[model samples]
Each structure stands twice: as structure tokens, then as C-alpha cells.
Target: MLNDFSPAAAASSFSPAFSPPEVSQPAPPTFTSPAAAVAAAARLAPRLFEQAARTDEVGGFPTQEFAWLRETGLLTAALAPALGGAGLGEPAAALALLQVLYHVGRGNLAVGRLFEGHVNALLLIQRFGKPAQVAAYAADARAGHLFGVWNTENPAHGVRLNFLAGGTYRLHGAKTFASGAGHITRPLLTGALPAHHGWQMLVLPADEQPPQLDRSFWRPLGMRATASFIASLERLEISADCLLGQPNDYYQQPWFGGGAA
Candidate 1:
């Protein structure tokens, strides 16, 4: 029930301004300062939870709540302290996200689900992206960019990877159940490569026009607000940098289920 991809509705631009990220932790255990961040979430919990959950039930993204998240330090929880973020690691950040989810769930499941995608997308950028990629995503997020995932393909099968003449590969077929389809500023997408043997991750700038929704139908009973939509790939251009890692890099990570589930 969503509209086709429209470039105009996408974000014009995004950039996050903050100090450089500290290189000390490829992945840290505890937050640089847990108490402070948690305390902050506690204070803003009432408002944040109410807004995100409400919008989820209404079948829309909580734009205002996301803005508040950016204003607050919650959205940048995983970025290093040096980068003007809470610098919380996976575990700590997970805890904070869970708190948000709990509040959202109390209000509505759709909101909690979408929020999880945003958090997971942010976490992936923080964990695997190159320095510049990290900095860019962090900057955009701080500057109010929304992120999500778009991996679920048709119930029949997922996207396929076709071996190309070069070392590169091509993605054929389509993906369904793309949540945050129109609202996200960036989305973590997934597909497979025939040469590789498993799935791969790719970060697409949602600032471009949103993808067109397929008329094909398979509506579920509940979770209507998810806005799960369909999209096709016909010779979409992607470079080596577009690739996240070897096959299955996305699903292999321990934090794969960090916020989504």
C-alpha cells in the first residue's frame, strides 16, 4: 500500500558534524560512560516512547521522535565519545535500544520494529564501515538522517547474485517486506552472489528516491503499520565499496539480532 520510489520525497542531503572517532576500540564491551547515557534515556523515555509508539500504530514513521533522538544523545550512542556521541559499545547500546523498544512496545509493535531497523542500521555502519563511511553515516545521523534495513525478498526466494565478466556481480530479482521503505534516509540492504556462496550487505543511500512498491500482494494479519513493501532491481549500479564484506558478512555478526528482534 505504499507509493512508488520518488526522489523528491527523499532527503536532500545529510552530514554529521562531530570530532573524529577514537580508533582504540574496533568493538568495545562497555560504554565509555553508561550511567550518564542511561540516565538521559530515562529522562526522555516518556516522551520518546509515546511518540514513536504512537506513530507506529498509525502506520507512519515517527519523524518528530526521530528528530528528538538526534537532539538527544541516544541516536549516536555507538559513536566514540571523541565524535560527540555517547560512545556506548554494542552491549551498552543494545541495552539502551532495548529500553526504547520496551517503551515503544508498550505503545505499539510497529514502532518498536521500525526503531529496531534504524538502530541496527546504525550499529552496522558503526561496526563495519570504513573510517570515512563511519564518519559520513555518523555525521548524517547527527544531522538528522534516518536509517533502516531492506533485505527481505519475496517469500518465494531472496535476491540472487549473477556472476559478471569482471570480479563484480549483479543482483537480479527483488526484495519484499522492505520496512521504512519510503522514510529512511539510508538502508542496509542484503543480497547474494553466486560466486560467493552466501549473502552480502550493502548500504544504500535512501536519500535517493524511494523504490517503487509492487502491486503484487501478500498482506499479513497483524503488523500493518510496518508498511512492508516490494521493490525490484534491474541493473542497479554498485561498486566494490558498495559491498560490505564477503558473503554472509551481514548475518555472521553477533549483533545481527542486536535491536531487530
Candidate 2:
């Protein structure tokens, strides 16, 4: 049976540890109507699919196509209405995202998957962040800035995070298959601090350079446009502002975990 991921289902499945702690007020929905958002998604779905082939071959981002995404206001659909977003609930937003992924996958699965990650990051900020944080990210998203999550943990204790004395955090390990790394303006990266309780995510500016980036590692049979390159961080300096939320917000919930793929 095709799973119907409704709001009630989401609430029931949400783990208490991962849930947002009690606050004074609840945030409002960003989308007004599910039907309107789905209709809008349908319009952009075909074009994204049409360009998927070329996007894959070039090992580059579908920049122009994403520009169209911005024009359609689909990019800001995850933000709350107060932050100038569509104000749709999670179920409606996920449905729209599924539609986008379906079309993108028709020509290039890589692009579709990458787009899914981008949307997921936006959803994360919308859900767990403070008002100021949401406003900042929402503004950038509305202005056509792209974002994505960069967490590819392996089964064998692959990744580790370290905290330095000078208010800088270092990522000791490597992240493989960082989809849309090259094209994303912002990367929602996840790593753990040494001796810390859990993992933390940071919104790293994409302009920052990693100590070691091997382009050849990305040479693959498919999904070339994704630029899923391997990058190493001996000791990257990330300011405090780079941190996304409180120490445990990243790994707490499965809501931020699912990708369109």
C-alpha cells in the first residue's frame, strides 16, 4: 500500500526525544491549501524532468531550472506564513516534494534526489528553528539561494566532530555523496563534537573550502550532476554562528531524515 503520510501519522511517529521542546507558542503552517501547492508543483515538474539528462552529463547544477523554481515560489513553500511562506502543513509540503522528485527522476535520479535534500534542509529550519533563524533562512531561500544537507554516515563509525579551544569546531572525518555540494549556496552539515552527547548540524556557507576535495572520487556510473564529491576536513574552523540548533536537534527526529529519494 502506498503510505499516506498525513499530519496525524507524523505526530504519532514523532519521537519524544526528537520533538521540539515546549515553547511559548506553536508555529503556524506555511501553506494555505494542499491543492494549490500541488497544482503549482505540477507546473514546474515537467521542466525539471526535461533538463535532468543534460544536468546529469555536465556534473553541474541545474542552476537555470532552479531559478525557475524560485520564480514559481515553490522554494519558499516550506516556510511559515508569518515568514512569508506558503504556510502549508507537513503532509501537503511532502506531497509537493514527492511530485517534484518524480518528475526529476524521469530523466535523472541524481537531480531528483539532490532536489529532495535541498527541500528537506529548508523544512528542518522551518520546523526546529527560532523565529529569527527561520526569517533569515526563508529570506535567502526566497531570494533564490539553494541549500542541502550533508550527512553521509557509514556503518563503521565513519564520522566524528571535534571542538577546538578557539570557539571553532573541526570535522575530522569525510562525508561522501554530498549531493548538490557544488551548486548549493548553503550546506546543512552534521557532525559530532568530541566527548559531546550527540551530533549537531551547522549551516555552513558553501563558499568555504575543504582541505582535501577529490573530484575523481565523484566519477560514477550515474548521478554525475549531483557532484557528490568526497571531502576531508583535517580541522575546519566553523564559527559559533555556523551552528544550526541546540546540540541534539539534528538527530532527534526522523522528520528531518527522509529524502525524496
Whole-model lDDT per candidate = 0.59, 0.61
Q: What are the RMSD figures for all models against the true structure?
A: 7.2, 12.3
Q: What's each prediction's clash count? A: 8, 7
lDDT tens digits by residue: candidate 2, 102-174: 6545545775566677677888887666677778887777666677888884424345667678887766665
Q: What tens digits encode model 1's per-residue C-alpha lDDT throughout 44-151? A: 667754554355443444566555555555666656666656655546455665665565445446655666677678777777788887777877666556677887
Clashes of 2: 7
- The model with the greatest TM-score is 2
The lDDT leader among the candidates is: 2
Could you tell me every candidate's TM-score relative to the true structure? 0.71, 0.75
Candidate 2: regions farther than 4 A off: 1-32, 88-97, 103-108, 154-159, 208-212, 254-261
lDDT of 2 at 248: 75
